[model samples]
Target: MENNFAENISPAFSSIYEEYETLSKENYCDIYRRNTIRKHVETYLNPKDTILEINAGSGIDAVYFAKAGYNVLATDIADSAGIYIKNKIKTEGLKNLEFQKCSFTDLSSIENKKFNHIFSNYGGLNCTNNLEEIFSQFNDLLHPKGFVSLVIMPKFYPWEMATFLKGNKNAFRRWKKNGVLANVNNHLIPTFYHSPKQIKRAMGNDFKAVSIKNIGTFYPSLHYNSLHKHPKTINFLMHLDSWINGKSIIPKGIGDYFIITFQKNT
Candidate 1:
């Protein structure tokens, strides 16, 4: 959480780091991410398990895990977000969480020898085009049979496609390619979208897929701030998402984002 850490990050993400929480502060979509992702993480992790979290934005998920009795090393590329997380950890008097300023591509800075889980939430993994190299490091950082949980933006999503019906064809097919330049915080950065199969192949045979579940399939895009304004309607969609959440691969892979759990076997 050093003030100078911003010098190391790309401009697009630096701008995002500035507006990260402000965009989602009072938004229910943020709550939905917290509830949905936390449930999946808790289901696989036991109390006191150690986790190395990549792109641990503002430490929201890290705090949740600490309160649940897990030790976490929260790593991020942006110092601004890391500083915010550090303050919260201090205010809450949580000793189980530590913040480190580092990108997902480089974990060499981390001193931790091994961890029970290696995690990346939301679309952090999408920011890079080199999954094979990144996943290789993730596997090496874990203990044998340790779990890696990733919440990824799939190559195809209904929400992106929905833009097509609104006459925004370019926006609709942006993710169809393996890589795209996305405008974030008014700066362009390269982003890549990978399908579940592509990710499994990238991870190679050292890991086995445990489970995949749909998230935000029916809950509307997190960008839709008006969801909270219609409590009854949003609640209905939330229930529908819960019912069909893990029922099939079609829904699981086709949602806004999908959770894929893998256990290292080597």
Candidate 2:
């Protein structure tokens, strides 16, 4: 087995990850947030291309892509994630989606398969220390002109720093090179924060940056559970984001999460 830079994942914890994440899930306005990301992701994806989704939590995004008429192979380190997608596949009779229990760094099981796109969402790769190792593999896995879209946390997000006002000392946790341990379901998981520059270098010279858009920026955070209650405010932010998102509108290092896309240099 290769060294898993995502130091804390294990079979025992895998079964409970979804449950552990419920607390955050309940606090997050996911529907609105997901639609926002999906809108951006689909713009870069070709419906005919097979997508390999890493860190596929609950296989939600995979199912979404499949339903939209794309072929998808959803892979996750957690075995439970496989179960969720399998159940969804069976229930929906989805023919275009496949599931596998796999880790991002160790995708040897599917080495023979090549894809036109790669995706990972919700900062799942943040658990690993080896950003370069992961990105380097994309060149081999993707065809020429292939795209990779990742929604991951950057080394800095302005809103999180506001935690200092709430008297939280670990406001700048992402700044730590060694990473910090996040408590989930009484389990401490190691989480790392990466910057766009670091990811670009890790992607080597084979990949070119396509676009970087702010995932959660300004006014209300994605984690703000009650966003639905304030539809007007959220709408304004969405409207504002539309203008500044993909056109290099939002400044780097300012979003709670960022959707960074890269394309293989043909």
Candidate 3:
């Protein structure tokens, strides 16, 4: 069944991925994403800790952590990701960063190893339909009192809803679907959306939420037209977002994504 799904979705996903890779570095959305991940990592991770990053993408965050004195193991299920990350490590001479191809659905291969911090940035965790299974796997991978930080798309995004209301029907419909068939490297990937409450419930009693922040609240999503034409405007929005993002009320559901930090119980 999984193989069939992958085969069906591969072509579309490959094209999507190619486009993503091309725009990732320069896109304002991508820049915000990188900075958000870096901020959370700096807050929770210690210098000597061993960190395991799931869905490491281009391994950019892993390189940052490794450079900061953490031992890093970056994994992604995408075949292209492993080679991309390895080449990056070689080019940068980052000896402390290791690259692997793995999936969140299966951690039996790495279960014996424990990490001081386990992280998945962006919508990596959103790929799974079963949050319980994924959280259980995360629990198994972390040491006692270790941290797990995840960035996921929130179920009710005010900005997205507004975007949709302005006749951006596709944007609105995307969230309404709850689960969508996303293409990744010629593979049709099943993606799930969850509310913050649902995620907390799925983690059960083992993990406790430390903080949750809304990302991209003031700054628009990559698809937003204004961000493309106005550099100064985008920069101004980013600065405003940095100031207002984690406030108790205003920014809660306005962003494109949310970052949630949790700690494994001892």
lDDT per residue as tens, model 1, 79-135: 576777789889999998888888776897677468989989988888776788788
The segments of candidate 3 whose C-alpha lies over 4 angstroms from its true place after superposition are 1-24, 174-178, 183-187, 251-254
Model 2: per-residue Cα lDDT over 92-134, one tens digit each:
9999999988888777668678898999988888888788878
Error of 1 at 92 (Å): 1.6
Clashes of each: 0, 0, 10
Model 3 scores a C-alpha lDDT of: 0.75
lDDT: worst 10-residue window of model 3: 5-14
Model 2 worst lDDT run, 10 consecutive residues: 1-10
Best candidate according to lDDT: 2
Segments in model 2 whose C-alpha atoms lie over 4 Å from true places:
1-28, 222-231
By TM-score, the best candidate is: 1
- The best-first sequence of candidates by TM-score reads 1, 3, 2
lDDT (CA) per prediction? 0.77, 0.77, 0.75
Better of 1 and 3 by TM-score: 1
